[model samples]
Structure formats: C-alpha cells, structure tokens
Target: MTERESDVVIIGAGIAGLTAAYRIKKLFPKCSVLVLEAKDRVGGRTYTVDLTAANGTDKWDLGGQWVCRHQHHILWLLEELGIETYKQWLDGKKLMQIGGHRIKSHNSNLPPLPLLSLLDLGRALDKIENMVKQVPRDDPRLSKRANEWDNMTLEALRDQVSYTHATRDTFDIAIAMISGIRPREISALHFLHYSSMAGSFENLFEADNGGAQEWKVKGGLQQVSELLTDKIGKENVILSEPVKSIDQTEETSVLVTSETGQNYRCKYVINASPLHCSVAMDYKPSIPLTRQSLANRSPVGHLFKFIITYKKAFWRENGFSGEILGNGGAPVIPGCDSGPIQLIYDSVTGYGNPALVGFYANAWQWRLVDLEVRKASVLKHLTEFLGEEAANPIHFIDKDWTIEPFNGGCPVNTATTSALSFFFDGIRTPHDRVHWAGTESATQWNGYLSGAVQSGMRAADEVLTRLTPEIKLDGLLQELDNKFPEPSSSSVRGAVVMVAGSAMVAGLCMFMYWYLT
Candidate 1:
C-alpha cells in the first residue's frame, strides 16, 4: 500500500468534502489535508458539461444546478470565492400540460386548473405547511407521529385526500423532481420533513425571484467545486481512488485505504460521500446498526438532468417563455411512464446562449427505454410544446445519475420509508474519529448546495475541536447538526416502526387547530 500521513483525510471530492478541506486549510494553514474521490471528476453531484451551438460552445450543469438567495451558505461561499450569479429568465408565458389541455401562466404559481382543483391544491398546501413546522428534521423519530408516518408511502395518503386530478398530478411532478423518487416510494414523514427543512413545499418548486430557482452561478456550479480543489492544492485531491476500507484499529489515528492500494493515515476523517456510497466501505469496528440499516435501505433518486441547445431563444421570439411544466403530463404521478419530461426551464445565460433544460421523471420504464429512443422521444415531445422549431437541437447533452458509477444518483439521495424514523440521529453523529458530512446530513437546506456547505463546515469544526482540546466547539456543532434525541445506551437499534395509513386525519385535524387560531 502506498502510505502517507495527513492531518485530515476526506473521501469524496464533491462540494462537501472540498468545502471542508478548504475551510480547515484556511483556518490552519500548517495542517495537512488529503481528499480522495471515487469518480474521475471532482464535483460529486454537481457536474458541468460543455455543448457547442451555432455561435460558440456553452456550459450547463448536468447535476445539482440552481441556488436561491435563501440558500445562505452557498450564496456566502459564492461571494467569498468570487463567483457571480444571474437571475433565471421567467418573463414570457409559461406552459403547463395537463391531460389533453394546455394552460398558460406568466408567473410561478400553480396552473389554473378548475376551481375545485385549485381549492384542493390550496387546502393541501395549507395543511402540509402547518404540519411541516411540527416535525423535527434532525431526529424525526422523536415526533409522536414519526412511527406512524414511516409505515406508508405518500401515495397511501394521496388516496385519502380529495385532490382534483390536476392537483394530484402537479404534486407528483413537484415531489419527484425534487427528490427523484415517486411519492409512493418514500414515507409521508420523509416528505413532511423535507418540506419542513426547506421552510415550505412551495419553496421547493417555485422559480420566483426569492424561490429556490431565483439565480444560478454565472459559470456552471461545478466551477465552485473546482475552485475548492485548486485552493486546497490539486495534488492533495486525488480522483479515481475508490476507497476500499477505513480502519481506526490503533488509538492515535485512522487509516483509509483505496482500491488502488493507496493508503492514508490521518488524525481525523471527514466522510463527505452520500450514505449509499459510505456504507460500501469496510469499517473495522462497523458503523452502528441504526446507521447501517439506514444506508442499506436508503434509495438514491434517479433523474435525467438534460439540456438542448438551440440556435437562438426560439421560444422567446415566439412570445413564449422557455419554462414548461408537465402538470397534465401523465396519468401516473410525475408521468415518467406517460411522458418524456416532467419539467423544462430556460437555460439561457447572461452571455446570450439559448437553451432549454429538461428533467425527466425517473420512471422504471424510462430507464428501460434505449438512449436513442429517449432522445428522439424528448425531441418529439418538445415539438408538441414549442412548435416544429424545437424539433431539432443544435446540441444535445443528457446525464442520468443512475448510470454514474461512483455517484449512485443525482439531485440527492433519500431515506427509505422507515429508515429515517429509526436512524435519523446517527446521520451526522461522529463515529469515533470518523466524521460525516454531506448534503443529507445538513440542517437548513438538506439535499441542496447550501446543506452541503453547512455540513462540511460542521465536520471541519468537529475535527478542529478534537485537535484543539482547549475550546468548546459544542455550541457551533449543535447549531450545525440540530440537537436531536440521542440513544440512551449503546444498544442503538431499537424496534421502532411507523404505522401504515395510521395518522392522516389525526395529523390534519391537529393542524386545523393551529389554522383556526
């Protein structure tokens, strides 16, 4: 094994790992830092690809892309790193396809379905908004209803709600695009907890000036990750080194071994990879059962983040905004089985490159379709919405995270229906000297860039505290990882499960009480 020593070793050279290394190095210049990445690239979930158009070649993010002013951590980092931002274009008419009808709207609001449908949407939103505040994100198991909600998927509850067909379709699209999983695939509490973390469900879907879609980095988001690698010194960030195991057998330090026989010994480790990838690494003493079960059961969402470049912003010239929402997309929620794409957005930059970004629902059927067939179907679908002018793209590029080797899926990974309730606390807790930091472990914007940065800083603080031994980092640590209930003893895996279809009426009724006051 090629052996080396460093102050800290981070696995996964994505934003989280890179940010942690950058922050720690900035604070303690003398400290040695090493980052190991499994993929051939640096940005974990954030990937920037180049496409040539009529005028010139432009860049688009094939992974996690958008950032809102509300995402404070990433926004602050952009400013510190000297990255600029541009507002997303939403000035023209936007289209929403539902069933056989097409609805047009000039704003980010839900489509103008029938009055009954609109009412259904409003009620569902209000009820969900109220319930969001009550569920604690750090440890959802502590919530009285956690055990009950985890037992069933969101689809089970959808049946009970008196939503108009249109409203239901809209909900499915929004949810699937955000988490990359069908509502029926994830627990209701998982949905509620995510909504709570983002402050509201609307914040997850809106493209308004203050919504999650507000602004994007001037260059591709991958530039941010690349800069971190540059700042930490490129030699220290090793790519294509899939970690084989981590052994902290001795008391003084921990040893990390890669599949290529590269060995690293460091005082502490910041495991910034997703839970799915982290669990694959062999740990000597083994991670807690609670964490192990969560990793084993967790599902990485599948999504196609694709972009089609055009000679010009053709939609804009035709008086149509480039935004397209597939509300009436398919009978199936998110309509992956029924349609080619669930959502489309304007990918035009300040530099005048014209393009349309599309996200296809990760349906099992979609994956089964041949790549050429998928591409042809997408182009045909665009023709129906944007006219024959959209029939051909100047350049076409798409990435399905499911196919990526090192990185399991895109956007973010999610907890299974019953996993979060049982293993929530262990998500960010340090196991001996091995610390965890990833978007999934973040507090504010879990699954977003903001969350990745927040978790990275939290892990850095943890390592710094242990090395210093004089200062109390608990306060900062607590703020980063929200205070959740800890297991009373080492017998970590408890027999706690959420009841299926058990608490909808009761939870909503409780919310009604808050609504009345």
Candidate 2:
C-alpha cells in the first residue's frame, strides 16, 4: 500500500474538521495537513439543495438553515464569507392551537392564556432567568450542574410547577418537541442552559429573516464548506476514505486500513468524529478510560426537519402569519404559529416560491416516524392547523436522524445535571498528539453548527500550541503509545460485556421510569 505523511491528520470532514483544517492552514502555512472524510462530500450534517421551480424560483435548504444574531461564530463566518441575510418576517396575525381549538390573534404583545396559567408560566420564566444568571458560561461547574439536572426528568419540573393536567400536557409536549428529547428523558438543567443561550422564549420566537430567523444562502449553505475546502486544496483533503483504525506504536504511528484497505502514516491525529463514531473506530494505542466511558454514556438528541412546497404562502392569505404551537396531541397541542412547530415560515427570498419548514421533536416525531400509514397521518395533523389546503403540499421531504449512518443521531450536548466534568475536562483534552473536536466538545453553543466551528478552531489552536519548538511531536507520540497499549482479545471481550451490562441497566431504569411514572 502507498504511504503518505502530513504534519497533522484530521479525520471526518464535517463542519468541525473542515473549519479546523482551514484555520490551521491559515495559522501555519508551512505545516502539511490532511483531512480524511468517509463520505465523498464535505459538510457532514449541513446539506443544502436547490430545486428549480416552474416560476423561475427554486426551493432549497436541507440542513442547518438558521442563525441567530447572538450566534457570533456563525454570524462572523457569514460576514467573512460575504453572505447576506434578510430579516425574518413577523408582521401579521399569529395562530395558536390548544385542545383542538385554533385561536387567531393579530396582537403580538402577549401570549394568549387562561390568566392564571399565564401567571404561572411567568413565574417559571423568572426562576429560569435566575438559574441562567447563576450559571457562568465558562464555569467548570457547568457540566456538573448540567448532569445533576439531567438526573431530574422534565416530569419532575412539571410537578414542581404544580401545573394542571392540561397545562402540564401543553408545556411538557411543547418543551419536549423543541428539545427533541422525551420530556421524561431530558434533564431540566440542559433545558435551562438552552433558555439561557436563547435569552428567553420571546427571543427564541422572534426570527430575523422570518420565524426562527432562518436564512437561506444566496447560493446554498454548501458554499461555506466549499469555501473552506478551496482554501485547503483537494490533495490535502481526501474524500471517500474513512479511517477504520488508528494504530499508535512506539516505533511508528500508522492509520490502519480504511474500508478500501488503504493506510496513512501520521505523527498526530485529530478525531473530529462524533463521540459514538469515535467509539466504533478501532484505536491501537486505545483511548483514555474516561473518554471511552463518556462515549458510552453520551445521550443522542433526536431532531427532524421537513420541508414542504406550496404554490404560495396560503396561510398569509387567510389572515394568519403561519406560526403555530401545540401539545403533542394531534389537533391542538401539536401545532403552533411560532412555538411548538406549528410555526411555518416564508422560504421564498433565497429559495423558490412559497415553502414551509416544519420541525418536530420528542414522542410526537417518534410516533410519526413509526406509523405505517404516514401521508394520511401527516395530512390530518397539518390540515387541523394549516387548513385543508396545506394537506396537498407539492413537494415533501423529511430527514430521519435515527436512520442516518454517519450520524447516529442529531447533535446534543451533555445532559444538564449529569456529571460531565470528566467529559469536558479529561475526554476532550488533547492527549499528546491526539486531539478531540466536535460540537459536543464545545463550551459555547454546544450542540449547534456554531459550536462545531468553534470547537474546530479551538482544536486547531491547541494542535498549533503543541507543535511549538519547545515540545517534540515525535517524542510525545512515542510516549503516548508506550503508555496506552491496545487491549487483548480477552480484554476487548470483557470491555464489551461491561458496556453491554451498563447499557442494559440504563435501559431498565428508563423502562421502569416510563412504566411507573
């Protein structure tokens, strides 16, 4: 087999890996860098499509469509890339559905409420504000507190709020759908962290270009990844080459055969793959016990995005702004004008004619994906909230994260109130020549596209620091291999058994909670 070399080798050409490669080349032009991607394409989870229309417009955006004003990394990148964004339209009547009843209001000032329930929600927001203020953005304690909250289910929080059955159902379903995790499975702390980052519910609802402040790239989001790839050159960025094993030896550092039986030798390796993917890949010198353990425990978030094309933004014609929120229930709680995904937005500026993007989370989606009878079910739900006309969308597309191979699931950070000190402190730390960078490893915007870029940039910085004259990369690689040897077959079996047992226990606990609670 042919052999190759580079100053640094990064696995996975997702946003994180691509960003790191670009930044490293910029910082140290003399250093040789190589990026190996499993897929033939770049942009891991960011996919954008251009659908030519009959009216000379195109429908698009398959992934990563929105950016908030507060998301500095993405905003800055767009500015640097010379991408323009338009304000999200928020002018007109908003719609809300609850218990199968649709409430239409032109007033944007206050949330419709049964006064008392609204007051309770206000009190809850106040408490959340206090919680956010107390948690520092960069504190080490953030992970610990987040874990603690993870242990307490969302149901527990609902209980604390003393919500009525209807109110509890509405809030729980809405929050679960937004979070993409079952209310009972998600930690309250993680929920709080999201609130803190978003600023408030109102802030989250207020879109920049439209609802969710979503923007379509004038060309496509793919342009961002393409720009970075152009800077790195085609030779250095290898595609359709997935790294199967990373063998670190005292004498030589080798990347074992990929699916195509090819190997690349490198002095240092940066693992930008997601935590679960990292676990699946073989490591000759082996990863740290802490990192392995965390990988086994990390929770995967479920997020689904669907795009529908209509002849026009018909809801607008009927005096509706196309934002809707609802409980998990079909007629009422599942639709929202702007809250629980009853939120439909205008996708005409960058893409084609009238298009609507729908997001679903938690059990609502779980049930939706499983139904043998899908189209009718979806139509029923849409018709209830979006009128009978919405039932016949011209183009329909959906992305199921669970079914994706490269990505086991949608992006999610450490659970709130769960012990993540080890994950952030030990697992994410650079070990000699090996470094970790992904959305999960980021401190800010932990589970977003912004976080992935930030983590990549930070990992590149760390690698540059280690490559300084004061530290010897070759010597460090040797020490790493000597200290961490590959496990024997018997040991591998034992480890697998241990992981299986832990998974069983965790599953049992989840089942019991679901059954009894």
Per-prediction TM-score, please? 0.88, 0.79
The count of residue-pair clashes in candidate 2 stands at: 31
User: Per-residue lDDT of 232-260 in model 2, one digit per residue for the tens?
Assistant: 89778889888888877645455545778
Cα error, residue 264 of model 1, in Å, equals 0.9
lDDT of 1 by residue, 231-323 (tens): 999999999999999999989999999999888999999999997888889998898887778877778888777789999888999878788
Best by TM-score: 1
What's the residue-level lDDT of 156 in candidate 2?
A: 81
lDDT of 2 at 149: 56
